[model samples]
Target: MRSKPFLTVAHRLAILAYIVVALFPLFWLLKVSVTPNDLLYSEGVRMWPSRATFEHYTFVIAHSAFPTFFKNSLIVAGSTAVAVTILASLAGYALSRFRFRAKYWIVALMLVTQMFPLVMLVAPIFKMLSPLGLTNSLTGLVIVYTAFNVPFATFLMQSFFDGIPRDLEEAAMIDGATQFVAFRQIILPLTLPGIAATLGFVFTAAWSELLFALMLISGNDAATFPVGLLTFVSKFSVDFGQMMAAGILALIPACLFFLLIQRYLVQGLTAGAVKG
Candidate 1:
């Protein structure tokens, strides 16, 4: 009994430590954002600032192009996440339910695509998109992001589909429902966790993507938040406060996205446990 209590305490402490370690950077970013510029360096590693202000945030919102960047990022990431999830759901369902001669080769080809460094393909992708007038366009970024994310998202959804029992869909079909109806009304509801996970994964990827955005987008109007953040850097100095403020603001959509999906994620996990 004593040993069990000690183990429980140890587990709690370990989790607490991990949480602190993981969140310290974000905490620091928030800390710095609120800290006054004069006291930033002078504070010398204090956990909180003696004086805090919202001036940085105010400046970013009122005087900067951050709002535009935020809008562009929301549009790109939201569209890409929705597109990938839809495609991934269909592809994942097909892969999970069907046995075809080409399935192995198809999976292998996707795995091969992941094996190559993205940098190697950037030039070729650019060359291809340039001819189609997709360069520097949000549509181009969405296309690129969707293509890159769909394969992994498909695999994610497939694993979820595999976890569901075939008998569930079989029973639904026996009631005169079509396969598509069975999938839509029965199988999909059960795979909510997988769908939520895929959406969050793709959204986070599209939200933080920088390299492709930088390489393909040339002007400020089309810039996503990650690329927009670069505007804070100059040869002589960096705007640490404004940058941190923007970072915090950028975190809002992602935080809200996860919050919205978290309930479904939990329900999915619980359902899986019960099924198991």
Candidate 2:
């Protein structure tokens, strides 16, 4: 049944309100990033100041170490995303398709791993990494982030694989394709949406991670953007302008990443793989 026009308008208004509420912080971030420093405090709660400037953007890019942080963050997040998605895709396919001994126990163990608070494990992790020379290194952060993100990504991919039918692979195998070939040629293609989603999810998680990056990285050289944001805080005052500018700049990679993947991110990758 078609809804009444008044009800449709009310529903749209409600949704618009929620969107505004959700995006208000981002709007504010953009606003502050452009607001002139002189007007920053003097404006005292105005949405749009009388004038705006790109001074913060210029300063952050040209004068600050934000570029280094950006590059480091890109490396860490990209590595983590790629590594986690690869491991998760393979593991998820196995979990979804193959039957094996102790499967339940293995999944249970993975679930148990996810249950522990990360902070509780930080000390142990630090001690473990220190002796291995993994501490204070970008590789160490990638390892840690990959480890943390894999279980969740595995589950995410498993859901997608589960939605796909086994018949396609079975038919491919019957037609003389090897299991690996069938998986690569047939199943993987249908899983693009899931892969894109997993990549985006893992990338964002590693990008914004602060606690582990802070504790593990001692120098600015290896610091991710989130950890580097702390540099804006001096003993005297916080440079909100440069910090917000950096934050805005930091969003570029993730936004670009999503833009690249969004075509594949459309849901229902398995739509035509199986009969409805």
Candidate 3:
């Protein structure tokens, strides 16, 4: 009943509204980060402050322990992403292509693992890591993240592999290429979108994770960004400006990481849409 132009305009408006709603918190964070300390309490909720300053940003970067926290988060997230992707790719391929005994049981066990709350597992994980000198360490964090992320990542990659025809790999094997060689040289290239998605998901999960980082890492030197954010909260007050500034700074790597993979991310996310 509606005109095409009217429907088109409605669609666009809906998308614009969604974008604004999604980004409003980030806009508020930036506004608070740049607002001067004096005007924050004096003036309640202005779209833009009368004046803004970089003093919070300066203090967070130069005077605080944020850089160390940033570095630790980067290391843990990067390592976990790479490790989980590699392991998941191999495991997912096997699950998609091979028929073996106890496969269903194995998958069931993995599903069971995901069912338990992470909080329930944390104490035992810490106990297991402490004896091995892995607690309070980045390597420990990477291992923990990889373990937690692997099941879902493997399932994600398995779905991607399922979407592809198996004949391509068969053709490669027929040409005298071993299965592993064909996988590494041929199929892996086609799976880039899935790899990007898995890397992005795992990286983001590890990046913003607060519980494990807070529980495992006691020393400030080993703390990740999520844990470091707590430093802004003291006995009586929270430093909203510096904390917001740190939050903004913390958003950079994640943004850049996704930007780097967004091409593949788009493909990965949309690949399933055409199936219907």
Candidate 4:
């Protein structure tokens, strides 16, 4: 009985340790971004520099093509998230609530798509997109991101649907609501947490995607944030300070995006806690 408190204390300590470990990189990134170029190498090992300046941030914002990169990434990631969520919601509802022929095969096929290496697909995808005048375009990126994200997203939404009671939808239908009407009004509201989860997942995936962006977009005009970060690198040296500053800046939109959906995210975390 006395061991219970000890175990609880140990568990809390472990979680605290994990949080510190997980956040250490972000802390370091913030630390280094504000560290002046001179002090960066001179006092790189310090947890916080002796002196810090926002020169790196100023340079990244004022002099670089980061704004364009930021805009491109926002458009691609946002579009992909919305598109994936809408399609996944419909497909998931179908998979969860309805049984049809080839259902098993369809699920298996989606699983198979996830099995292959993304690296292997890069060359084929590039070749396919190149001739369509999409190699250096934002639309191309959105289409690609949506395709890659949909299968897993469908599975995610389907799980949420499965958690819902079919009786609710049936009752709605019995009250003269059509299946589509029941789904739109009665079911979708209850699945807000799942939709939030899917949006966050897909948005982050598209926002941080580098390999596809790097391969598909060669011009700076269409380049995403990840590709834009590479501009801070050159043959002679890497601009660590500016790069870190840009990285810190890049995190803002994603953080804000999550903040916007934080209520649903909290609900997602606490879902299924109590039974009525």
Candidate 5:
């Protein structure tokens, strides 16, 4: 019992340290966002401001085109998340269960796709899309983001599917269900954690992605939040306050998304689905 107390204290301290390290940047972002511009330079390195204001947030929301960029980002990220998760779930389950011809070659091909730097493909992708009127379009951005994100998402989901047992589906099929029904009814419920994790991963990736969004989208109408943040910079000066405020606001959806799905992420729904 005495040893248990010591272990509990140690565990709590470790968690506290990790929380502080993880949340420090976010705390600083909030601190700086509220600090007045005049004090920004004058304060130098204070941990907290002498005073705080909501002026930066007001300016970003009212005076800037951040709202439009935010809306576009939400649309792009949301669509990409759904598309990637759906494709990855199907592909992952197939990879986990099916033994078919050229499986090694197929996996190797997917790995090969991930090995190349995206920059190398930008020129080729742009040239390809230009002929099809895809450049400067939201649909193009969605399609591109979905494609880039799917390989990684598929690998993530495949790991989860691999964790689940095959017995559940086999039992479901023996009970007069088709393969698809067994998958949809029995196996899928057990993969909720994997689905939640995959959705969170893909959504955050697409939400913060800047390179492809910047390159493919030429106009404000289709600009993602990351690209829109660049507009806060001018030749003469950068609006640190507005940019930080927008940056802070940009985090809300991701935070909410994780919060919403976190329940599934925690419950090990597959725990009893298989034998030890």
Candidate 6:
């Protein structure tokens, strides 16, 4: 009995330590963002600054082009997540339910795509998109993001589908429902957690993407928030306070998105545990 109690305390302490390690950077970002410019360097190594101000946040919102960048990121990430989830759901259902000659090859091809470094394909992708007038457009970003995210999303959804029993769909079909109807009505509802997980994954990936956005987009008009953050750095000096403020702002959407889907994520985990 004493050993069991000690083990429980150790487990809790381990989890608390991990949480603090994971969140320390974000806490620092918040700390620096609020720190006044004069005190930034002077108060070095302090957990909190002597004085704090919202000027940095105000400047980022009003003086910078962050609003346009925010809008562009929202559009691109939202579109990519929706597109990837829809396509992945269909593909995942097929993979989970059917056995086809080409299925092995198809999965192999997707795995192979993931093997290559993205930097190697950047040139070829740029050449292909340039001719189609997609070089500096949000549509181009959405298309690329969707393509990159769908394969992984499909695999994720497939795992969730595999966890579900085939008997449910079979029962629905016995009641004169078509496979599509069974999938749409019965299977899908059970996979809410998986779907929410996929959406959050793709959205977070698309939102933080910087390399492709920087390479494909040329000007401020089409730039996403990741690229827009670079505007704070000039040849002479970098604006640490404003940059940190923008970083905090960039975190808001992702945090809210996860918060919105957190219940489903938890439900999915609980359901999986029960099923297992």
Each model's lDDT: 0.94, 0.93, 0.93, 0.94, 0.90, 0.94
- Winner on TM-score between 2 and 4 is 2
Once fitted onto the true fold, the runs of candidate 1 whose alpha carbons sit more than 4 angstroms away are 4-8, 269-276
Judged by whole-model lDDT over C-alpha atoms, candidate 4 comes out at: 0.94
**Which stretches of model 2 miss by more than 4 angstroms?**
none
The TM-score values for the models, in the order shown, are: 0.94, 0.97, 0.94, 0.95, 0.93, 0.95
The lDDT of model 1 is: 0.94
Evaluate model 2: give its TM-score.
0.97
In candidate 5, what are the lDDT values of residues 1-276, reduced to their tens digit?
346888899999999999999999999889989999999999789999999999999999998899999999899899999999999999999899999998889889889989999999898999989989999887898899888888888888899888877777888899999999998998888889999999999899999998888888888888999999999999999988888899999999999999999999999887655566
Residue 25 C-alpha lDDT in model 3: 98
How well is each residue in 47-109 modelled by candidate 3, as lDDT tens digits? 999999999999999999999999999999999999999999999999999999989998998
**Clashes in each model (backbone N, CA, C under 3 Å)?**
0, 0, 0, 0, 0, 0
Best by TM-score: 2
User: Where does model 6 exceed 4 Å of error?
Assistant: 1-9, 268-276
Q: Which pairs clash in the backbone of model 6?
A: none
Per-residue accuracy of model 2 over 1-276 as CA lDDT, tens digit each? 988999999999999999999999998999999998889999799888799899999999999889999999999999999999999999999999999998899899889989998999899999999999999999999999999999889999999888878899999999999998999999999999999999999999999999999999999898899999999999999999889999999989999999999999986667566566
Q: Which 10-residue span in candidate 2 carries the lowest summed lDDT?
A: 267-276
- The global Cα lDDT (0 to 1) of model 2 is 0.93
* Clashing residue pairs found in predicted model 1: none
